[model samples]
Target: MSENQYAISEYHDADEINARLKELVGQPLHPIRRDKMEEYLRYFDTKCSRSKAMTDEAKTIIPGGVQHNLAFNYPFPLAVRKVEGAYMWDEDDNKYIDFLQAGGPTVLGSNYPPVRDKVLELVRECGPVTGLFHEFELKLAQKVQEHMPGIEMFRMLGSGTESVMAAIRAARTFTGKKKVIKVGGAYHGWSDQMVYGLHIPGTRTFEAKGIPGSASRHTQEFYPNDLGQLHRRLIANRLRGGTAAVIVEPLGPESGTRPVPFDFNQQVRELCDRFGALLIFDEVVTGFRVGMGGAQGYFGVTPDLTIFGKCITGGYPMAGGVGGRKEVMQRFAPGIGGTGERAYIGGTLSANPMSCAAGYYAIEEMERTNAAILAGRAGDRLTRGLKEIIERLGLPFVAYNQGSIVHLETGAVMLLDVRNPVKLLKELKPRKHMMEEMGAAYMSQGVVTLAGSRIYTSMADTDEIIDEALNRFETVLSSVEGIA
Candidate 1:
């Protein structure tokens, strides 16, 4: 495949990025200046009073005043009232450049008119769901297959969590093996078994509260980019009823915050083949965003099963599915005949006409406009500008991109691993708080980012938009302590 076909212009060296991340975490916290943070917080108080009032009232009914995890912004989440290409307006009408992109689904940008219009037409014609067959379901699946031929068949589900659950169940049923291995710190969604290693590697079950120990009994994890550790675990699992599947986020954990080497996926594929295990690529964040073919296409490696997440519908609801070779995918066939033979999974609104139409049209538009490559160019510009700002201000920060999925590591909170349990435990809270403050600072300057660290650029992010965002980032980064 040509380089232009995928979002990643080049693959980053995992070792080099890890070394920089280590240096960042080793240093004392370089938080936003206290005065600057107070000022930014005041922006939330004065400028966002309406948002405060609404979220405060919501807190009485909703836990943490927000429903989704991404909505948990520091100093309380902003109530978004409007979202368009590359920008969103909070309830208070405060305009900001959108880098979050609805948590990496809106590659064509938020509320993209083409996709929205198509969805509206579908909803008007047939309604959202009939709890029955929809033609668009076949159309959407065919569209996905057109781009990703490895997915000989597709099964739609309600959410990424549900899709992952179905995938694991299918793996176990197909292979008749109990154990499944995953890369540590990679989120395959909030499914019980996959929740063993949440944010930090080696911290098994640390965040798996309220769940029974048996839930993750067969789940295992190796450190990110650590193939030797994974090999040993696979070897160990062989003695214990053999391995079922090896799942990974092809772009590495947290969408390349902990990046993998160029050949990582191919190596993992080889290991899976050698161990008689199925390879599952969790392309929830990477699927269409990386390219129409996904990370597997970008890396020139194919997996037995591929998981598609929110982007399947171009940020539309009911956007999750599992696709793979015909033999394995047939395991998800809906019927009543095979009790133990089939991997049963169902969602009432899984392949709603609205979602199917939206996904099909959105993907068609993506291919028509070459959105992924355009978005990647924007990411390259943004990362380059952020790096220049960091260097000029003499700050201990890191900036890089895997195409449109850009990562700016100002706090390095996610970099902390269980390798040094004492350091991780001691620094976790402070580092986390620092990230929260940084996010708030950026928001105050009219930039919305993911945890103040990761930024997802879209095709709507033109040169002018990117340059303006860089100015906002420069203002936020320059306010860090010791920056002249």
Candidate 2:
């Protein structure tokens, strides 16, 4: 064994020291009980009667009273009427400073004049799809390549899920390996193969019902930040013909379902190299939002294949595909047993001109103005303000960010700490109802945010808007008192 392996084994063998280290690392920083979070939720429930009414009405027509399952909150998602710049007008004619940013795609903000004008112009000219190549496709792909030089060739899809599904298929075909290893809690779209251990945790299982057990049979799962465990799994699977690829979010910097250390990704890259497995970075969330070059550039560990979406389309319905070494991606070309043998990837609306036009313009705008840096600055200001409030209130909460992606979690630090751990675990357990309440409260106060998951900033969000949101956050948090 190598020196590093010998040292790791020796460290694990030291039972007494390991126990002490675990205890030290598991101490609570702040102690806020789960019951308080629940109480706060109950209070918001009473205050958000309008939201409930809307949800009830929506249930009659829409599934779960929302278009996407992730969009559904405890009270009900507010129906949006119109959005311009960084603000949204909901169905009740209430105005809100929108930080949701269409779940991170609207980095340039909704209805930005330039992108809007271009999309409308395209619509007027030739409708959405033509079943033929469009000029906009090449333009957008070229822009993506220009920004992130790692992506030599690219494809477009309708959603992040579709892109991820296609990337997985391409990886399997390219490597001739059937199994894939994914991080336990990182979300990578809704396909059956990538669905295992999604929102609903524990082992390899799907969050949605009716998923075939056999769908993820060859798919293995590993915890983030545990290199030894990952290596063991890779070796075990390799003995049986190896894995096609190891797919990860590359930034679980925040520990939740899978909080990873900074070195975790670097180590994972080394292991993948040793195992002869392709590494796939699912950058749908981190794509253009985190930086113009995505997480790969931020971390400086290039992957064999990378998947992108969200911010690339600038909030349009367009999603994107995998890009990597020429050889691996060439598996998609014809005559390698034709299209039937290699990855048969296609979509009716893939790379439609309208989306491509919007995407190309959006990327151009972001680069021209360096909007990503501005967005990061805004996120920093907001997170710092929230953290200050939490400290003053003596609340057990933590706030952190990855460039523009920000998250605020109550009891997150305590959950990570605490010797017994059960108390914090129970407190942090899925409080969907509480999250919905928080969302409604924020909405009523004219500040919109995702329920404890992710939030974004836009070029249109001014200092005044951010300040307003922070002040409202203080009020909402104070109102909750001992709650989350």
Candidate 3:
């Protein structure tokens, strides 16, 4: 760990998160309490009428009445009116202590003022995109390299999905290998190549529908925190052809919904070196939110390529990127790529002055206030308070966090084996439904979370805001206490 107090959030300085997660993983958490779920569903339908109306209206035009699956909460999604700092108001004017943090990008909080102002200024100044270079893009890349010394070069992209695709292409092109291995249950993105073995590790493709089996033939899975498995896989792959890259969410999928050991990254780094595989850190969720340098910096293990998502600006139009050693990053260049042939990657709206300004100002604000540490502190407060609530209510639900990213796993149903068609169809239905219900339960009580399983705190979440969130959380706990 660094004696420098600033970058301390990078390291696993606090074991409480790991300890709590270990206990939760072992504990037998049941399906969401049936009565509790029914009760919450009723409450949601009754109290969230405005949201229901909006969703109904949306479904008329949009499939499922929601654009993103993340919006598909139980009963319906809560439509937001506005958000600022640590709170958000719904269309019904109900207030919530914002914990979703826009799925881990808005460490400064939604519509953060300074960044927003800068983005507006840039939009007015340059009209979003001119297919030309902008100074802010250089500044943003410089800022990333400044904090993460591992990144000798960087490229901004459209979204985390785009970034993942670029990184995968770069890795394969740079190494002249085809095989890609990622941790089981980790979600790199929705890109076709990365759609293999998502949500649960070691499973057959669930989200790979319509994507040909051959599409994922070279892609494989390794269990998280299991270096032995990775070593074995790399050696196995070497027999046929060298593994191009080993990509992973440094803290585990969904920002440590399944937390990893403190030394996991170091072990992976060593193993990647021994196996001649490029280590790619998928920092889309962990990037700047974990610390200034990200999980690679936190663990003191730099990967050959790093995938950045939502690091540029939270909830903005354009987000995500790839930062890595100059050699690997050069593969995306127009002229002689790292592979001696251009590894194709580009975007019309990518690295526009608007997104760059938002990212540049966002980082500036976060650094000025040490937003990562403060957000992590808020996460600690929220997690601890949730633990106390769970204990008091005697609920079997689990709670743990990594820096600002929090996980409240109600069951391990998502990890169920998908290879068995019968089991897959039978188990996933109720589990998915109830999970959304649990999210709705929290939403009903003025707390908007990420699918009711995760919480992303922001620097704006003070003790008071967290306490307010906790009070709402207690209501959720009480509603679900029937199971206990």
Candidate 4:
């Protein structure tokens, strides 16, 4: 497919976006007015009494009353009883526009009937797993390879974290090197080495609690979009044991929360080639969301290896994999098939029959409906509408999208980095709180978002749905303290 055929029709200028983000963080917090905030919070206490009570009871057993960090809403997490198309109903039967989209995996929309029916049929026929090979495994692999030609060989895993671990291990084994470098603030996974620089650049090990120092000694990070800094690290690692791989989220870290220039990936590929290090694309979010061919296709930059995540199974469980050129992927061969060296990765439920079938059917469905492009249209509409709202309200918030992955920076919380330690220390708490409040305000207005900052639009979001969402968003944005 051509570049325009993919989801992202236009790539935002990364430098300009970053400059606007800097200006946003430099300003005072423009949170919802106190009266408006209290009124919104009342929605949780009164209207959502059932959800609040249920979460409170679960808090006695579950840590933070939620298993996933994304569920950590400001007032409290809501118990979702139903999801379909572009909406969700909480336990209290309150409806919300589902902008979260199950954290960007449901591009085809939540609980899509076609995919779900196929899964149910497969379950009734042969159960979920069989500890052996199935035809859908080959079908899923072939489907992925058909879309992402760079992924000549593929290995299915349990989750995105496992896929990252496997990719790093394969890179090291193939190159006979020990070090790996990643863009600071990019979230590849929670593995020890990958956790070195979490959230903010230069804050290495800040969130590496309980992980020993030795766990990440060989891992390093450089500032986002700084090719010079990356080149320096590549040269430095040369004097040591040499770099194994340089991994990145093709759009930017945290799903383009920090957007990179259009040519950033191509430059990184060149540096990797010059330094004899493998380039890995952590496409956990961008793989299918950007297009059937992924960000590599969008940017026309091929990586030695690419990681896959939830969208592989269309939001089903056990959705992760690693794919790339045949030579490097050979390192993941199991049993006695390998020549001599092996990466040695295993999972009891990896490539289960249900997951494979779900992935195969999902990809087929995505291709048939051109879901990525449709979802991207929804994202474009939503983003344009959000920008209009922010502009009309005279707010400092920023909004942008890379296809279906949309970011609305109300507090610019994720933009903070250790590059400005004093500023980080002074504002991190209030900024984070403001982000949470923004989420609460949106929820009260019957819109669900990912932490009040990120949103995932799906093929199900029609122009009508997007316009309605924009109206709700305006309700919250207009409530900002300084808004006219």
Model 3 per-residue lDDT tens digits across residues 8-82: 344343345545554544554455456766776786666678988988999999999888868777777778889
For residues 372-402, write the lDDT of model 2, one tens digit per residue.
Answer: 7778777777777887987788664556555
Instruction: Estimate the TM-score of every prediction.
Output: 0.99, 0.85, 0.92, 0.99
For the record, the alpha-carbon RMSD of candidate 3 to the native fold, in angstroms, is 2.9
Sort by lDDT, best first: 4, 1, 3, 2
lDDT of each: 0.91, 0.70, 0.79, 0.93
lDDT (tens digit, per residue) of candidate 4 on 72-153: 9989999999999999999999999999988888889999999999999999999999988999999999999998889999
Q: Tell me model 3's lDDT, rounded to 2 decimals.
A: 0.79
Candidate 3 collision pairs: 10-298, 184-201, 185-200, 185-201
lDDT at position 34, candidate 3:
66
Q: Model 1 compared with the native: what TM-score?
A: 0.99
The superposed Cα distance between candidate 2 and the true structure at residue 153, in angstroms, equals 1.2
Q: Model 4, stretches more than 4 Å misplaced?
A: 336-339
**What is candidate 1's CA lDDT for residue 160?**
86
lDDT of candidate 1 vs native? Answer: 0.91
Query: Candidate 4, TM-score vs. the true structure?
Result: 0.99
Summed backbone clashes in each candidate are 0, 3, 4, 0
Candidate number with the higher TM-score (2 or 3): 3
